[model samples]
Target: MIESMTPEQESNKPKRQFNNLVNNPVMEDYSLRYAPQSFRKWSEYAVATSALGGIAYLADFAIGASIFVTYGFASGVWAVILAAVVIFLTGIPIAYYSAKYNIDMDLLTRGAGFGYLGSTITSIIYASFTFIFFALEGSIMAQGINVYFGLPLPWAYLICSLLIIPLVVFGMTLLSKLQVWTQPIWLVLLVAPFLAILFKDPGAYGAWTHFTGNAKGGASVNFLSIGLGAGVALSLIAQIGEQVDYLRFMPEKTEKNSGKWWTAVISAGPGWVILGALKQLGGGFLAFYIFGALGATLAVEPIQQLIKGFGVLIPAPFIALTIATVFVFLSQVKINVTNAYSGSLSWSNFFSRMLHWHPGRVVWLFLNVGISLLLMEFGVFGFLNTVLGFYSNVAIAWIGAVVADLVINKPLLKLSPSYIEFKRAHLYTINPVGFGSMFIASVLSIIAFFGVLGSTAQAFSPFLAIVLAFVLSPIIAILTKGKYYVARPDALGHSAEEGDTHALNCVTCTDDYETPDMTYCPYHEGDICSLCCTLEKNCHDMCKKPGVIEVSMRK
Candidate 1:
């Protein structure tokens, strides 16, 4: 015996409605749903270029300089390399799954192990990463404006924050074109100063290699210094989320295009860390070269670093300053647009699950930028190391849990699903596998970070987070027998099957979505889109009740 919704019962249910912003594909960019095959029209190269464009951020320069200033050359260099390796390896599985599944990181997290509502906290963590980096990048831009244009920091922060809104409002429609067009000039400008330094001041390299700042042992590698430096650098582990935001638009892979597809995915996915590491090393060198002239406070600033690097090539100081300022402006705009765009998506996912309402992604964009602007006004740049070091603990735990589920639990242990299942109808509200592991790891790591566990533990707290989360995910999954992974089996046919482009009409929204984004709704007596399924409040998950069968749509 099973319950069914009668026609009269269905008629009385609330109809789904969305505002104009969510309805417009250009404005929406499928912020809360899977990107369909039709909308994924860009070539692999185009998507990869657009994704890589965000790497133009100058924060790497400041981060690298800060690490070197805090630790000696040996420790700082090793930390950057070590962090890059870890970021690259962890990023591979996440990037592959997101691109292959054509869903953003938030959606992937829901299916990977975090469950539906279990991923809400991760959304907040991801959103925090976006705004924190947005503020950091904004601060760098403001510093350039203060030096070159004589504008106050406050006015410059406001201008920088507002300028990115129009660009991000359109989402990928405009960002792809913008990235392709500006990439050439940005690359040329990026390499010019480094090349000039190599030729004009070759001796600076030797000087930089021997330079020691506030490290305990001058010019020698300290394990503690390396661990601390790596912790600050690992804060960028969440950067993969921003990359996946663009990678979700990657076109479907086929036998004819498999090579190009993999190349694009790998290059734009985890390959971001390769270039990131180089930029950080360059930043360290520039800071070292300019350290004597600029002192500690100014040496770590990207604008000052570049101004000195360009001075090696340009005889005129005004011309060098102008070029450095232009580069800073260009870099900030490119990265901030990504930060704002990704933040909006994260916030939308978070609030939709919590409040069951989505005003639109555009509304969240303003909120993200507004928070970043406040951080800049407070001069967050001064505490760069402190801010990033603390953030890495929670971020690493989140990423570690997701990666373990993707690589270990799914593939090795077979405790998770073979494919991603993100629909609200099929998922439980919470899955203790990833959520619990992240929670336990984050708490212990935070305690260690605050010196509760001793100095050694404090410096390597992020490492503790990753290791604990990674190991605990499978243990939890096995203990729970993987029952909580999905609340109900997907009654809908395999939407991920090869060449299955069949579109299903969502009864609630009266819109056509691909099979992947459609799920059978017992309450509606028809297929419902994921967004509508997520927003339905009256059903109370009747589909998941024992012996409650969903109406078949086989006819």
Candidate 2:
């Protein structure tokens, strides 16, 4: 029996759909999938380099410097080390998950316990992570532009915000290429200033290490100082999201490539702190040297301090300015592009899950920039130290919860979901496990920060956030018996709640995915991969209405 062709089929038979290279794994950079085996063509070195490049922002220097100035050398140094250790340990599991599964951080959060709608708060947290830092890096860039071009502060903000747009529009593809190309140049400039300073006085950093200024306790290593310093340093804990964006592209580990895979993951993941710690120490050292050499009255910002530090190495003043300008610009460019790239991905995940609408990453790209611009206009720099100190608590809380899931809950009680259950059709709306826990942590920490819990508690807000979020997630998961975390088996794959090999197609990008990543999106009225399902605007979550545990609870 012959099947008759429908009107839609008859009209479209002659049309050739452009892959737009859409299905071409390289161009799209696995934007919609879990970096299927067919993709991940880059070498281990390239992947790690690309990943490392994302952390090249000048904020590390700025943060380190500010901590030094406010907390003194002992407090600042201790804080950097403590924060680095926290970030590195937490980073290990996150990097492993992203690299092993080839999924982005948003998808990872869903599988960990946030579920469909639940994971979204993490997206906002992550998006806020990006923009807050974006404003920071942009502020540094704007400061440089203002110094060099004599531009108005607002105009500098505009240029700093606008310059990175072209680079971030194509997302990871352009970023990977840009990062790869600039690696050597960035590396050279990063070291040149330090090398010159060292050459000028071999004993400079040595003396700087013991230098202390302004703090009432001096370098006596007081407990209050260390706690505050740690809180300040730990504020950058959210940087893991940016790392996962690149880790998603790591080639699937096989016997042949296992060593390289491990190497890449290590170098790009926790290894980010190697540079971060160094920069912090370097910034502290620079502040000491600059204050000593140029006198304490100069009152320069950290970025400007670095510029001047580099400028001295060039000897000829104008050429020194040019070199210093280029170094700062390149450093900001490298990091700001990453800030914008991660921001777009996060905003895309956030709004898509909440509103079920994704205009495109490019749209959120502008939104991210716009937010940073607003922060600049509001003069966020004035409160930078207080803000970072306060933010560290929430950041630590969020990352700590994720770390707890990865470490204790996943193994001890088997409470963690066995595989990442990211698809919309297969999970609850709000797990209450991650959502409820993080919300409680953030709320409590914020109150403590405002001194409702008193000055001692206020100083330890970051510690409170980390300890509370970590402790509560497992308690909630166990009390609830991990029921809200998953309502049904993730996919038609296995005996356990692990994913298997039922293949399906996306609605927008129209790519096939393993059953684990596919969802029945009502907007597309078909089975679409989670990424495409995420990108579609009109769904209104009709598919999950009956399934979401939150709705059931209200009913």
Candidate 3:
């Protein structure tokens, strides 16, 4: 018969010594485990505002301008609206699940159907989103620097890249304060250009409605144009991952705080797209307003757009340029901090699972920023449309698969487990349901995007990814009977309830964690934390093997 290990045996095993960066809760921020209730002490408003602050990025402006320049007013505007609707709808379930479970997108993905190792691929995809957009945002900042300070693009790129590192190193403890404090100033600058246009140049709006840059159909709403435009806009679907990075820190909900909790989740969660869509439209209008003066190539640049807007309000050219540069700098810092922060989390998840060792989240922060710096040096902004358009296909498919598992499989079909099981000991290495569906959908969509299925199919390729992933996830779950989700039952046999804040001390790490992060390790014959379970190389998953003796938690 199986029996619990004695304390003497547990103490005889070696204890892991994490570096100071990983050991400090303020800096570590539970990058690889559940956000226990004790750590989620921030108010709902504070968390929501910090999450919302990440949307200060100017990529929406660039995307809007790019689409409108390529496809015309009617199709571009409609595409922005369409993409926002889809993003908002899909974001709802993901945000709710992440907030309720107190897990980041990576942890949630592991349980949502991708399983333990299956999420590694999605981690790369998500990390790609961070760096790709980081480079894009950093490029915009470089452009402002080049225009105003007369700095070379290379130097500007270095400055922009290095500036975010200090801000992000401390994780949420510092980030929450930074984001909340700067939000007001960022908001004012965000709307300054539009407000200037409304009062100083009202006729620009009329001209914007009629402007058509390179579109063959002029201002007409062509179906192909709408499809292609929406594809680029939808590349941002993975942004929900960054939002939930903060949402995971949400305080536990209760009858008293229920209203504030839901409000924070919805507003800071999917509600981000509402502002994002507006920014896109605003970007399109600004691009149109300045096209005559700056021509096509330079008009889409946010710095140029803001300069022109500020020029209208402030008659002095020098003052206008100074303010515009300041605004651009502020915006980039706000969003790039988030990009670097989220990228570190994603890279941590990827490397820890792959190598069975984690240096720390802070180590990966430099890696993420360094990759973005390289891209900025090479001028990724020049190929903006091509880059984002192609990326949307794969991103939407991954998000679609995760959403299907969250919304359809768990509740309606009752195929997946009701509560998330992210701990490695209780989950299989891979589950075919989400991983398979996403893979198939991404491959087919990429093929279509490359015009293998002809022009119309190519234009609508992202839609193909979304439909196929959503439809296939439930079907695959039913076919597999959901056996791949959990490798073994919880050894403690405790209820997988969200509100259970009871803490347990891991014998290996010698640290106290909430019950959800603890699991029985048959190899060590003791309870282990999720981070320790992930880093254990010797166990070889002995606890999960069939006919292996069950190890119970010590009383």
Candidate 4:
């Protein structure tokens, strides 16, 4: 019996039973699948625009305003510049890898060393990224509502939070079109008022340039304040997850389109930060202008404050109120939709990975919105600076680990997997590499945020998170010897060395997925589609020869 076994069989390597699950293209979307050439469909321009569209959150405006009030325009300016630089530099590698390979952030994390189970924790973090920002953006919308219709902030919060459920339920297809359509209108509304104001009063620019408002530290350029402000803003760094959420649709790269592909990826991936920074600067400027005109300091209502700025453009009181409300509504709509979309995907990924059962992304949309609603009702926006300031630590840690894996660990030590391995059946439950890096960075950064570090360092905790994560990832990967990357021999499907692009099929759902999405599912005793595999809850992964990372770790 043994003698008859061929080498492939003699090795006792597991073969998938439900091949249809892995091949289904419609259900999976390469969520937990390998990104094959065929699945990467959208053009470069589409991906970039989709990514840039999501940055339309009003949090940037509020954040810039807060920084301007707390520090001066100079300090706020510096912080925005610094955060943008860091975001762009880190985004380059992440965007390049995800689009080049056509995997989502969750999938990328698997190959980056989070392993199968290990990546679950990151899922929560990533999910939080969506919901947290959703709350922020929703709150902004609520503020607009209160100003426009005299609605209570709480009711406004509920309205704003609940509205996205319908929009996101349709998923990427609707989202892409929505972004394309709204982008042009939002851009015009966003820029036109400011451009008009500048033309109307060229001297306003002069005043704005030199105007230093009520700075607690005496309005002088304080490096610590600047760094701290930047740290809070840097919380948005993990926003790349939202970007990659769309970029998985990017068209395949080839000799004919390689340059265009890379350019699109960068613009979509990290290039979003450039526009975000500009928007943030405008927010700061607007906040500054409002404060100057009011001849007062410290306004809790950003909308109320912003309304004053809009008054400078439109002479009529009622018309100006309407315009300001419209601007805020547009900004919030652009961002909250993205927030809901990304959150739903992240929540779907998280629970399915944990419970092995997926109801659908649409279900998670409600969950994500529910979480945002709670945060909104809890009045998290009241403590806006505090929440973002604390969150920046964790966000930085997560993004830092990701950047380290993509830019530093993968290239420097060769510990990174040759190709992205995102299928649940293909990776260890958890790998110490990404997890350890994130843990260490988060812990240290939290300490810094809490003032364990000195004042300046505390304000600049995000930078510290970046440094620590960047330093720790390669060391852990080298120490782990890349053992935990894959749980078993059969886990690695298709040779990446053959080429970067390939096609795959799902066993369940009977559709074609990317090679990355295709995985042998032991639960159904067949190759499972990424979506079913993601939603699967029964088998408990019986394919790894019974003693891989789980056993290794317990020992």
Candidate 5:
């Protein structure tokens, strides 16, 4: 079998499928697939504008308020800062790789040591991030609708979920326009209430700082409380995956545009945390102010927080209510479009691997929205802290494993390959280095979160996940000798060694693909695009021997 193949045998393979780009115009967004360099036609500034605009979400406000209300001002502030730093640091490498490789988080995970199928788990994790946030954001929108228009909560939930489908179904083309257009108003509305508080109540800042939360360490800066708060805030660490979904459309970096490229990558990538942290801080201050006016129960609610803040500027209850409602509605729309879009991409990747069907991203879009709608009806916002707290452990472990492979394993240990190879034909089914590390990290952190390790460890579960994943990735890489990184050398596939600018015709899809997205398909007897290869489950292990598939299938 090893000696059977010749150049003639390889070249004689027939094409299997036609490209479906005409039917799926929105497929340009390439959800469930790689964002190849050939398809990245947008300017850096355009892509950055779109990516940065996603951070306009009001969830930061709610998250900050929850932390401040639970842990008090000092601890809340410290947690926000600490979590931002960690999020920023971990986000940099992931962002850089996505933009540089022109692939979204799902594709990046595949090459980052998760292997082909191993990334399916991470994709589901990422999809959960999008929908959970979608449900949360949708609930926020429903609240605004209920407050202003007198709509039933259930109806509002359905409306909020439905409104985003039109905006997201067309993908980034319309989303970029929506984000760019709404950005100015969103910014003005976001800051207007804060500015009013600053001017009208100058002493509020001092009061906000001194006000301990309703927690046991009320008004004090407790380290344990900070740890817990940080853990909760770290749940947003998965938010980076969404950012990179847009950043993947960034123009390839070159000497001519290197500065602009770096600027876009940083600002749109980790720089999101800068704005996120500020929003959390602002949420803390607003929560404190709202607490004084509306009491603790209603203070953490963003609708109430904004209404109270705006109420200072407008004396009329109806006008203030309208302004706050509109602001919340707009903010929710901005973020939910992103949540839904990212969710579709994640779900596409996940189901494509598990079921071996490419149903187009739009199908998954509606599916994600439906799931989010269900969660909204269930009132996900009521248990936000618990959900995000538990989720942060798994999110961090997955991100930490990927980041460690990028920052530490590839560069320092040289145990793993330098370039990302995502095609199923080229990779093992499970690379123990990443899958193993993330599994161990998630298991330990979850147990610790349950207090099997102690209260201190319970509060620091996210931190533990990061440390364990970062440490174990390299350790496991060394132990496994990195043999699982690749099943066998696939010389026929486009790789890092090949120039990415060249276009190759995918034998399966019969469409032109850039080098990075093309892989050799033995069944088709030619180079096939990653999407086609992924969807072609019938091919089985024909491209490689049974032993290779056997190796990849083992833990």
Candidate 6:
């Protein structure tokens, strides 16, 4: 056939077309595939440092103040510790799998127990966390700008929201550099004020511990108050998703770097709560100090707390305000970029699965930021407590289900598959194991949150979600008999044991892809890439045999 073709005819033959939508490094960020070993080229420490930089957000300060003011110091202190322990424990497995498997949280959720369409629900939930935190962090930045430059709050909000767009549009490439470059200065400003206070006023700790806050509990700890505060604090449990987004870039582990690899994974993964816990505790102390100096209203504002704290070091009010604004602006920008970046990836996964079309992740970037800007204008800061308290229920239910599949159902009961299989052709649309447990837990906890289960349950809404989802996931897996775990053999049949180097040309996209992203397409009678398969809604899953289980059976 080649000998028969004229030179011009052979020259005019079509070249393979790469799917721009799926292959764009800026847009996809490996959203739907295993992050190829080639792309995971950074040192373990560099990736971990970049991931850790996002934890420098000021929301902890605000969260600390709000909880302490409502629950008093003794209750708030215990609540913060409890929430940290839970977050640390839950974060470990989620982090390990993402780093080891080189997949984002949505992909991890799919393979864990929530099947194809089942994880789409979690995609939306994770997207909500990104925008909500974006708005909050942006609002704090706006408050700081107003404090420093006297700019109108609306304009400040716009500036804060828009500033992150350029940084996040390039995705991890730009973000990694930005985070590493800024880490040093952020750490300096972050710790200097706290250290100065401790050195200058050693008695502040005693006063803060004895402080009654605005509550009627006095200085003593109250069990009910502790529950309420922990519920508020546990709302941050979803933050591990953000951490793992970067962790998925960890270089492939080898014997040479095993020690460094393990250290980076643990410290940058679950150990984020160590710095986070300290920040919250420091924030509580600052809020109390500010309360004593200013009043209850001003104490809750992070900008005010920073200005007062920094004021101790710099005597001039003007200079102190400028320095404080710089600190707040840098911190907010660091976290908001992560929020926008992660949110875009989540929305990409969500809309591609739901609508079967992806305009590109950058489109979702603007959409996420626009919504967050509007939220900032609506004053999300004013409703922080109520919003976080309510959000904690759904967030915990989702995390609890994933963790249960990881720690309980997969090992203890042997009710879930050991391997993570995320491809659509190999997964059921819905897996009752994860979806059922999360749905039941979220509904029941929301009921408890509203006091339908009485005041005691109301205060512990998040705990109810944790317990119910953890207990229910395994039961559902056992009831369903582990049949929903994997729909078919891997796309390459033996891709895991033999590394998939053989490239297959996708029938629809006319592109070559590695086996992990390619699938057998009975409709086309040729191999198809995952993006093509996802976009091919017209096929109606005709590739599978008639009357077969929607959940594919392992071959």
Model 1 scores a C-alpha lDDT of: 0.92
lDDT of 5 by residue, 253-371 (tens): 88999999999999999999999999999888898887866777677788988988899888899999999999999999999999998998898889878988766788888999999
Superposed by TM-score, candidate 5 places the C-alpha of residue 459 at a distance from the truth, in angstroms, of: 0.8
Q: lDDT scores for all predictions?
A: 0.92, 0.74, 0.92, 0.74, 0.85, 0.86
Give the lDDT of residue 256 in candidate 1: 97
TM for every model, in the order presented, reads 0.98, 0.88, 0.97, 0.89, 0.94, 0.93
What is the overall TM-score of model 5 with all chains considered together? 0.94
**Residue by residue across 193-294, what tens digits does model 6's lDDT show?**
888888898888888888788878788989888888998889899999999999999987789999999899999999999998888888888999988778
Which residue runs of candidate 5 sit more than 4 Å off their true CA positions?
Answer: 2-25, 546-555
> Which residue ranges in model 6 land beyond 4 Å of their true spot?
1-23, 495-503, 546-555
Give candidate 2's error at residue 162 in angstroms.
0.8
Candidate 5 lDDT at 322 equals: 93
Clashes of 2: 1
Summarize candidate 1's per-residue lDDT along 1-555 as a digit string, tens digits: 345557797588777879999999999999999999999999999999999999999999999999998896989999999999999999999999999999999999998889999999999999999999999999999999999989999999999999999999999999999999999999999999988988987787888899897677999998988889999999999999999999999998889999999999999999999999999888888888888887878989999999987888897999999999999999999999999999999999999988889999999999999999999999999999999999999999999999999999999999999788888889899999999999999999999999999999999999999999999999999999898888887776654534466798999999999888888887776889999998888778888876555334432
Model 3 RMSD, rounded to 1 decimal: 1.9
lDDT of 4 by residue, 272-306 (tens): 88878887877777777777555433343556655
Residue pairs in candidate 2 whose N, alpha carbon or C atoms collide under 3 angstroms: 19-22
The per-residue C-alpha lDDT of model 4 at residue 356 equals 65
Report the Cα RMSD per candidate.
Answer: 1.5, 5.3, 1.9, 5.2, 3.8, 4.6
The candidate 3 region of ten consecutive residues with least summed lDDT is 546-555
Worst 10 residues of 1 by lDDT: 546-555
Q: Rank by TM-score, descending?
A: 1, 3, 5, 6, 4, 2
Name the runs in model 2 displaced over 4 angstroms. Answer: 1-33, 292-300, 494-503, 506-511, 514-516, 519-526, 531-555
Q: For model 3, how does the per-residue alpha-carbon lDDT over 1-555 read when each residue is reduced to its tens digit?
A: 344557896667688879988999888889999998899889999999999999999999999999998898989999999999999999999999999999999999999999999999999999999999999999999999999989999999999999999999899999899889999988888788788889888887888888788899988789999999999999999999999999999998889999999999999999999999999998899889888888889988999998988888888999999999999998889899999999999999999999988888999999999999999998899999899989999999999999999999999999899998899999899999999999999999999999999999999999999999999999999999999999988877653554566888887878899888888887766778999999999778888877464423333
